[model samples]
Target: MFRHIWIRLKFQNPDKRRPFYEEETRRSIIRKEEEQQWRKKKARRQSETVYDDHEADAGQNDGFTPTEGGPDPLICDVAYYARRVGLDMEEFKVQTEDGFLIDLWHIYDPAEYTPLPPGDRTPLGPSTIPTSPSSPPGPDPETKKKPKYPVLMIHGLLQSAGAYCTNDDASLAFYLCKSGYDVWLGNNRAGFNPQHTLLSYSDPRMWAWNIRQMGVLDLPALAARVLTATGAPKLGLVAHSQGTTQTLVALAKEQRPDLGERISVFCALAPAAYAGPLIGKMYFKFMRLISPAAFRVFFGIHAFIPLMMTMHSLLPGGLYGALGYRVFSFLFGWTDDRWDRGLRDRMFQFSPVYVSAESMRWWLGRECFAKQKCILQTKEEWREEDNQDKVEEEKRSSPDASPAEPESGAGEIDKSESHNHKASTAWYDHRVPPFALWVAGADLLVDGKRLLRRFASGREPHVRVVHQKVIDEYEHLDVIWAVDVVEQVGREVKEVLWATCEGREGWRIPVGCEEVGVWDGKSEGVVGGGKEKEGEGNGSGESEVEEVGRARVRPRSRFGGWFRG
Candidate 1:
């Protein structure tokens, strides 16, 4: 780690770093000015209006305004960050099957939805597996207004749900809420506070879990709570990095396949299905070479690198942010080139959360994922599949090859071949939901393109790829943090959720998506409601949307130009 930091310090240009600092300074000034204006407006409004104390308080929280003291650098709370952007977050504790109480946050607009009181935000226990579709309940039954379609957003590794709330209006959770969705942020077990009903923190059994437990236990618990709270039978599932990994594993037939029935659509950002080239780095190689006992010795059985969390608690926010960025950049090769430099510090505050040493061991230990370079299949299994495919390709390409005369046992041979094909290729079952992928083309952390090929080549026969895109310039984190993410990823995700949504009869249609047709797998325009207008630039380095389809539900204005040069 020291050597990597030294290399960066020696080679990276100081001149290039100056622009990011300058931009952050400018943004800070703008935020202060905006906050001042908001205070003046609030005071004026209070003077003009006459109402009861309760009414006045409600009115005060209704309008859009910056936070009271501008952005707080030290605040790590999701609710606080949500309030900074005129939105509110309500926390609900969800108990997993194993009795771990994880946090689930709901992001709602103050004007549209009333906040649930602290006592009312009750802890939800494990749910029975849902089997049928049902209509969602309204926020207030007296008003007769339909509830927004519920959507659950899961965070990446070492990060909490707060990652989705840091970018203010540009944040994915806030953007989706404004665009008309009931957004819920789901955190895995033992995020910041490790609480359980039975086991104590020091108990080794409490820490004896890996990604499989997360997939089979934590994910389902969160999904169940979101569905029960919204009264919706199914909700759109969005995941990034390790979030996608858990979802992928859970949806597999051998795992908790029943969980997929509760999800309308799965939108994966930077899906980490296959190992990337970075797995071969020297440090990672060393981890792969070490024994499990040695791995436990290096990273204690309780938590992986607990010292990072200690620094997080002890150091000042600004100092921690700077050091955190440098350390993570050295380890993962992440840069703020595509992120908004003004919010870089805020983003780091949510990460480096508590993750188990066993989870890290499963990811990098000698006998697990790192050695096989895959989560599900062994290296030898992959090689055999590749050789079989090569032989099939050779047969297709050879022009001189002739068909042989049928022998007496030809029928038996064909049946055997068909059974082998199905057994070797299929990973998911019929219960799997439709998938929409936004792959980071430049990401070295995971090979999302290879996963895309797996679906496109009919390997996962049950998987339906409703929408797919490769953002050529995006890095692993850019799908959620990029400056233009609202246009490039957010808008598309909004439309996809609406298009593939099931049982939309009583649901509230989101803004800018009224014309989005339900995707029926027959036409290409249903997802975006228009054909791409070739050679027509929209002056934003993007192509404009043109309506062409006759689908029942069509988009009035399409969020096009996702593909960049």
Candidate 2:
């Protein structure tokens, strides 16, 4: 029933699901041997092919290394997750203008079905009823209806499509798919699966680009492919953290207004602009204030932060989650409630993929916030650049002072200075798309209020904030991986996507929506204290809390908060 003409269908029998990863179980060594045999046969067949000459020439000349020995056995993505959970997933590849082969995963369920029993069959239902006597009759009821509206989810910095599927049933991607929407997960260049048609992994050219390329080329290419495959004119977008930053770059900084017209609505979670309050300010200072070329000089051109993959690959599944939590919380801020500790291993499997050193430098360099030139720029970059002359002047005046004092000068960095005026102005001028903004109250990585005031409450609002919700105790990753995300964040995202698909008119909030908190410049305080019941237990036999009726609930300082649409 779903027509996908443009998508390259590699798996003819998607229903025959099996584990492809070598280390999925203790018998992985045997699986690896079987995979080697398959690769040898494939290579022999290629050698015997009539198109071998052309293919070889193309691969060699275009810097396509053809995965060296054989294609990777395991793909860490939504498709792999779907198969593990008894769902069907289709994999597609989109080639950007810059030659990066980005991976795309789609999970779809058909609407048609056979009658349950012979005697249960009912008369054919009418497809479309006439509005009046003069109106034309509808098509046959047996004819399949158009496919469900498509929804595309993009991930944040150091993450892949897998981020949206970490919570399985409760994840944003799975929830949308279960809600009868065609769900597609998008991967940026240099993501978990970093392959390309014309660039070899060994080639520095492959790792030369940054987030600018992502906004200018990758997002647009993926969007176009998804639209063409789904036969939909436009689709709904949900992005988080740095994902929101690049979407804005694609729409505003790159001046791709056409991309804006193609997205029905943008639901942003923890939008990553104005990062003066970034919890890992010390780490960024070590990178920017110390040396811009450190990553390249240290890691080489192969990949940035390749250890992330090593950690996932080497650590035991049970142990990795706890260790990963500590590492992530140390780098980003601590969330009130961590992702279900059970999910930490699976969640880290696809994240912290290969990013370009240039991209990292861009975030840590002179043009970060001042020019708004790249996606995911932080306030640290601006302060380092802005205070450079002053620092040099001080050094000359106090030549005999201890160098340690200047090196550890955290005093100069102003916590309140978000410095997002230029970026905000660009969004206003470019007419940024309407948004359902999710403000993470305890997120120290970015200043959420600066972003809200910039686009939502200006003298003339350029970007319409149709809906805004503040999760009082949430942090960066908690928006996606919280235990109660389904009732809190996912529900709102579902409603926003459904409303957009239904073609609702301008500036309208959904009925039965209750305001739980208000953003008062600095922090989002819960103005209501009504009690609420929690969901069923996570099979741990822990005491289950009672669920309260729809009401404004206050956030627990030690626990977390909840909101419903």
Highest-scoring model, TM-score: 1
TM-score of 1: 0.83
Each prediction's TM-score versus the true structure:
0.83, 0.62
lDDT of 1 by residue, 1-565 (tens): 4765775889964434442466456656766676665565567576886545443233334255434443466567888888777788899988888889899999988876887778766665664555555555644676677789999999998999888987777899998988889999999988888888899989988899889888989999898888777778899999999999899888877788988888889999999888888888899999999999999988889978877888888888878878888888887888788687767888889879989999998888887878777676766655555565556656666898787877999968876665456534466788999898888878888988777765654456578887777777778898898777876788789888989887676788888777788889533334554232454211133221121111111111111111000
Candidate 2 TM-score versus the reference: 0.62
lDDT, candidate 2, equals: 0.57
Clashing pairs in 1: 515-554, 515-555
Instruction: Check candidate 2 and list the clashing pairs.
Output: 533-546, 533-547, 533-548
